[model samples]
Target: MSDDPTGPPVSERTALRADCASCFGLCCVALTLTASADFAINKDAGTPCPNLAEDFRCGIHTRLRREGFSGCTVYDCFGAGQKVSQETYAGQDWRTSPDIARQMFRVFPVMRQLHELLWYLTEALTLPAAVSLHAELRASLDATERLTRLPAEDLAELDVSEHRDRVAALLLRAGELERAGVARRGKRSRRGADLIGARLTGADLRGAELRGAYLIAADLRGADLRRAELIGADFRDADLSDADLTGALFLTQAQLNAAKGNAATKLPDSLTRPSHWSADRLPTA
Candidate 1:
């Protein structure tokens, strides 16, 4: 993990490491890849990263920035990589046991995704503005943790996308509940918009125009938005953890922030704290 856990703690540096020194390069050997932004060569699932040296370190580690391997730089393991390498498989290298290595390799990605969700959900729960969604947050958190603890075979076969879709439904519902009873009036123009599942966390959107718009499950964490104009707009389960909006033009704090605000949540320049609010306001959702 990075020395500084502040800021958006979702970067690769914040992820856990597998301590490649003690184990074989199971991740590289078991996983396959095609030429993409993170890699330069086409490789199959069981192939190792070409940059992986025999010593289990990245061959291009010193020059990864210049070698078009920036993707590798951003990947975090959340400690699962090492867990798999040491605890689960007992430090067995892919070279020593290709079959087990393959299983580990396949499971690594699944665990990584779960960890990423945990990171986001945990961070989300820290926002005071999202108190209204506390039930939903806790539920999601439990679900995410369950997935993280799934058996390797089960995780490998899990349909993560389908799970994401299901969770999204709950988030959308939370958004609706939070924005209930707010009057929306304006020249509606955000019809048929595709803001669904967009990560607009902590965006500065004060006094813009968004009528009849679709913002379902948007990650509006820590956004600097205060009353611009929002009539007939959808904020289904959008995360607004630590957004600031003291004098937002038309938004109602009860309707907007009430849905999902945390203690770390920042408020607008002139708004007072909500009565049912918590002390841990998130920065912005």
Candidate 2:
């Protein structure tokens, strides 16, 4: 799995999904969390979380949301965790190599961003509406994949924000082309709208541009979100139990993680339902 141009195939693209079993608990270790509405305690970067197990698994994985670490449920390393643990580090454990702990921690966040670009590029290529841009998309995808395979020294020096900016531009163009119905959102664009705790159940948000919108705790049960551009929208604690999100573009796992959803919710093929979320769980009235 060293530098390969072809990258992971479409089927294997899903395999790029985070395999926490093969990971070194990077999210729980490399990342930090302070006592806030999200985490219950303060954790400095590079320190292993108290809930981290000997096998690199979260000891309280299932109880994370209940234990006041609801933020943990929203974080996704986008398969970077496994790639770093198994490929980049070549099976070395931090316990044995305390010297490389800093490098490993730094590389994890960088790799996660790179992997997220891979996810977007992979998804962009899947959209048939952007058929004309496929060649350019493929080129960017291959280049991003190659970057992810770079050595730790190179990765630490990478201009991750620059790469993300370039990739974001491309994804934006693709989203525009795919969602020809973009004009349907409304005359008043809700871009970055602050609708926290608003009563929006069953609202017609089709094709709405809600990028960076703060939707924390918004009650959106059964909302029609078809063709909506949900890039960077916060769904934290918002009720999405019966929402239809088919064709919603640019939404991330992190955003979805912050939301509450159930079996009736419709999501894109690229995402899987949070394990902590269940069908029988009723929305708070």
Candidate 3:
């Protein structure tokens, strides 16, 4: 077993992860998709993807990428889809009533943001360096959890960004405390840095502050990213064939799913190797 102290109890953690079987395909209908490397067709907000089946399952789920719906595979709603479909709406679906559907769609995104914050706050609470902030983190997590249970109308009208901004500030302080020892060595902060397509193969990035870095298409093969603050980092198409990310902070499954990796890439115990990642191209670690 791993020694990473950066996750909630198994049940709570499972709730934070997506449960598509309990969802009503909210992501397919509530969000928009544009034609690009990620998607093969254009879809408007509130419009359901043509691939969504009558029972709220994807028609090409097992072959989304092969069918030009690669974007679908990377999206994670942090369990908001099921929360909206089952808890908030009490199992009501859009297909039966246009009004309920509209409200559900509007509330889906709001719930997603709240859930994302909960995920981060929960992780922060688990960090030993952030022990001083545990009380506040717990409070924030509770408040965010309550928001997720609000009625559909209230959720639709919620100013989720405001809450997100507040949580982001708290998370920043916690991250700073966790990375303080490394920061003393003059390691530069790379928050929101635009390093798109930059070559960083075999780089040592331990304890680096790379929050929100645009590492899209960056060559990061064999890089060391342990304890790196990677919240909001864009890793689209970045290579991670043999990268060690055992302790990467605030790294989400969606981010990993969007990037390229192989069997040799070491990941935190909290995260799983993405199914799309190359399983046989490299030897296992």
Candidate 4:
């Protein structure tokens, strides 16, 4: 995960998959929806989408983009969607067993978070600049992988968010260690920014304000985002492949997501893709 949000081609980096067939449409059934550009109608957690076929496939999947459902296009499964459908419940249909359905719904979100962490950890391991943090990254990767393999019942019972927060602390430390000598001196304010690792990949940003920012390892694959405000910043190892940006606002995407934001999440151009886990409603940046 480079500092540039839009550093490399998404194809070059490992993209998580959505194995829907293996997961019995758990994501569709477990998650709720509100009417917006992404979904045609509103839905609750347990009910299946009207377009869901009996075979467990989306009826309008092929036409989602044209049928006013582009939101579905950006969604990623991080493998949890399929894992729960097949491995966790052993291909058990949530529709057939109300209890299992409830459990599956409960665990889907948790697993999604776990998968997101896995994505970041794996990406971190690929960075040469982060060589000093390799040992820490590997440890975090192992821990995150173990969490991914937890049994349904245990996963349902575990405090996955707390665990994610704990792991995130280590990752943040790694970033600090990697950029130790590069720290800027000054105070800035970047409240509620939505960076999510924008593909700055090599832009020139000197002395910007980035408080409560959302910069999740955006392709910054190697841009310079230094000497910025960075109060509650977020930076989840964006791409930063080889850009040049210096002295930007905020710090990381994780910091931004954990902080408060209104309808003003200033995002990087490259990370315009909507989150699959997020509802169609825009974030109150």
Candidate 5:
């Protein structure tokens, strides 16, 4: 259990993280893959990737990046895959029961979206500054959890975007309140900015609103990004070497995987350092 009064127990957060062993490789088959810098081949939704084994494990799990499927490495189902495969379908494999394949695939994305919201809501409850909204956040978390356990048919038909909008509003308010204490006048509100490849090395972006910002390939080495709102911020190829991201809002493991960071990149307690990063390597002059 968390010692902090405002924080949730560790189990609550762990329940929302992906457990691939309990999943049926839903992401390997159900989602579409476009041939880009991320994926090696173009695959339509519902078609199994050639690398998916009968046991639902990736054939090239260790060599995904080398095999040109780097995008697969960054995609997280947020525990939705296992929930759908194990609980929703009662541990049924799509290979054995092909009849449910289409519906199961349809429901996976919706459940993923819900789980993502649960992730953010869970984090929001941990923020001391968002204490006033904690009651509402808990309610939202409970309601969203109930939705995740709905029948497969109902899940496939769920209007997750509308629910997301409502949740987003509450999260927005929580972020504002949390940032208000640490954010300087000019550091707040960079929500959805086009900062792709911009030079921001050693920058002080504390408590900045960086939601949905195109920070692809941005130079963010040694930046002070503590308490910044990083939801949906593109970190693809962005250099986060030595960047302090402790307490950064809504920063996911997937985003860290997409970015270029070394061992010196400080992360939030909820997230881990991506294994692909160099071990304690320093930035070049």
Candidate 6:
């Protein structure tokens, strides 16, 4: 983490960590679910998940995956749940005041999006190669943070796309500078490439730029992705069981959560191993 007083932009250590204790099961109530393989049953929006407890805990928390609530395991509000419950709603849960339920559900997602931007902005500021753009990044971060604290009505009407576009442009420049600073020139850039299920085991991809690549279910076991620019790569179901991603750039927890990985997968320091990856499913030494 960058040791920034406002907290590391992307590290969900405390500020952005999911403080479930302070939340009122917003994820369960606000998010609609379909009876896909990931979920056991279809659920409507604004209705609480059947497994939710009165105290806002998942009744089947320990057995969520086996119990057909696998989708819940990968969801991360990035502390937006707690922020809405504690900060925005001021400790008033939707259950106690049913009238505010609709507004609270609407505000939760907006806060989550704003928090996602904060993560990206924070990461950009830490890149030394992007120093020239630091002033603008900081300003954007400050402005974005201010927006997260707005009233629910204003948040609902927020132009998130505009803010996202602004942040994305700044990040693109930052990525370019970082890539240029690297000693190895002419690195591979498979940006927006469709490499679905391609057998790329043990491929040498150091300093690769794979921004927005479609890598779904690709067999990338033991591939080296150190310092790779994965800005918007689709890693869902990607076989990264033994991949080296220690210095991978622009990778987020939400992205990792969606992907398939095991214990041997080397990840960035700021992120943690997903709970869904069991020891039996990991790559053998």
The TM-scores, one per candidate, come to 0.53, 0.90, 0.93, 0.62, 0.96, 0.90
TM-score of 6: 0.90
Segments of candidate 4 deviating more than 4 angstroms: 1-15, 96-98, 176-191, 194-285
Cα-based lDDT for every prediction = 0.56, 0.82, 0.87, 0.58, 0.90, 0.82
C-alpha displacement of 20 in model 5, angstroms? Answer: 1.1
Query: Which stretches of model 3 miss by more than 4 angstroms?
Result: 1-11, 183-186, 281-285
- Give me the candidate number with maximum TM-score: 5
Alpha-carbon shift of residue 115 in model 5 (angstroms): 0.2
lDDT (Cα, tens digit) per residue for candidate 3, span 1-285:
122334442127678889999999999999999999899999999999999999999999999999898889899998888989889998888998777888889999999998888888878877888877777777788888989988888999999878888999999999988887554354799999999998888888888999999999998888889888999999999998899998789999999999999988999888999998998656323
Candidate 5 achieves a global lDDT of 0.90
Question: Which numbered prediction scores highest in lDDT against the true structure?
Answer: 5
- State the local distance difference test value for candidate 2: 0.82
Query: What overall lDDT, based on C-alpha atoms, would model 6 receive against the true structure?
Result: 0.82
lDDT of 2 at 254: 78
lDDT of 6 by residue, 1-285 (tens): 243433334333457768788999999999889998679999888899999999999999999888987778877888889989999989999999999999999899889988877777778777777787877787888888899899888987777998899888898888878777666656867989999998888887777788899998888888888878888898877888888998788888877877878888999987888877644545533
Residue 20's lDDT in candidate 1: 60
Candidate 6 residue runs with Cα over 4 Å from true position:
1-13, 183-188, 278-285
Q: Could you give candidate 4's per-residue lDDT for residues 127-206 as a string of tens digits?
A: 45556667666767668777768888998987877777776676555444434445455423344767664555444443
Ranking by TM-score: 5, 3, 2, 6, 4, 1
Count backbone overlaps in model 3.
0
lDDT accuracy of residue 167 in candidate 2: 88
